[model samples]
Target: MFTLDQTLARDCAVVGDLPLCRLLLMNDSQYPWLILVPRQDGLREICQLDDDQQAKLMNESNLVSHILLQEFGAEKLNVAALGNMVPQLHLHHIARYAGDPAWPKPVWGALPPKPYSADALEERLARLQRSLAAVGSPLSFPA
Candidate 1:
């Protein structure tokens, strides 16, 4: 069986499930961020995924990059799969801007997380769901 890392569950909102990943939106409202975790059991590294799985993940990553660039108009998109804190086969997709607080730097530890308020979180979730729908993929989101 597979379960999301507790740390991730605490820090992110359930966005939806893609073909092979569980999409999550980071709780922070400062910058646009998303995470994708393979829905596989006991996997901590991308190398653990077979070639086909790897390719699928890459395609999904590209989909997210496209959303950030086209829908949000992000200046730069940062994609990483650092499992230092939570050793899950998860990837991070962050949207960066020139004058943002952590410009030219990473989003981690640059500033404390500003969790989205109830209204903000709702709006964010709705916008992201719409974005995914616009992509025409049959993503299944939480009720």
Candidate 2:
């Protein structure tokens, strides 16, 4: 069976589940970010997904990027599936602005992760859930 890495589990809050991916809201409030983790067991690479699954992940990623851009007015959308740090098969969709912290650079190691305050976290989570719902894919944080 596949298990989420401890670091990922600790750093990200569950946002919702889709047909092919489990959407996670990273704790970092610096960027509007989401992580998509496929539910395949013991998989750690994109190639691990079957052809149909690959297509689903891609389509879902695109849909997510579109939502982030339209809702947040992002200057740039960064999507990546790097597993160097966390060896689980997951993709990151980040909304970046030209003037955001660590602009023109990768978000990794740019600054310490600033966790959301309770109120801020709740508000952001609600907004994201509502947005996802509008896209016909409502999600929920893990209780």
Candidate 3:
């Protein structure tokens, strides 16, 4: 059985799921940030996954990075799997621009998160759902 960490659940909106990961959208409206959390229980590091699972995670991570660059036109994409606080095996994909507030620094603790407005959140979720669903195979979206 698997459950999302409380901190992650509280900070992100459910985007959908992939074959091996539960996709989440970080609620911060400041940038296009997404998270991929593997659905296995008690996993705290990427090395914990078998080779096949590791391959799948990379494929999904690439898919998200591609979309962020192609669709969102991110100048640079910051992808990381840091679990210092949550201790879950989750990858973060953040679309970055040179002029962003965090700029040359890590997004964390740089500035307070600006959550999306009701309509903005809805639209953003819909857009991401469409983008992910459009890429068929190895990807799944909840109805």
The TM-score of predicted model 3 comes to: 0.95
Model 3 ranges off by over 4 Å: 137-143
- lDDT, model 3, position 41: 89
What C-alpha lDDT do the candidate models reach, one value each? 0.91, 0.87, 0.91
| Model 2 superposed RMSD (Cα) | 1.6
Model 3 lowest lDDT segment of ten:
134-143
- What number of clashing residue pairs does each candidate have, in the order they appear? 0, 0, 0
Which candidate number maximizes TM-score? 1
Candidate 2 residue-wise lDDT, 1-143, digit = tens: 44667888899887777778888889999999999999776788999899999999998898889888998899999899999988889999999999999999999999999999989888887888888898787454444
Sort by TM-score, top down from the best: 1, 3, 2
Candidate 3 lDDT over 76-114, as tens digits, reads 999999999889889999999998999989999999999
List of clashing residue pairs for candidate 1: none
- Worst lDDT run of 10 residues, candidate 1, spans 134-143
Write down the TM-score of every candidate: 0.96, 0.93, 0.95
Q: How much lDDT does candidate 1 score?
A: 0.91
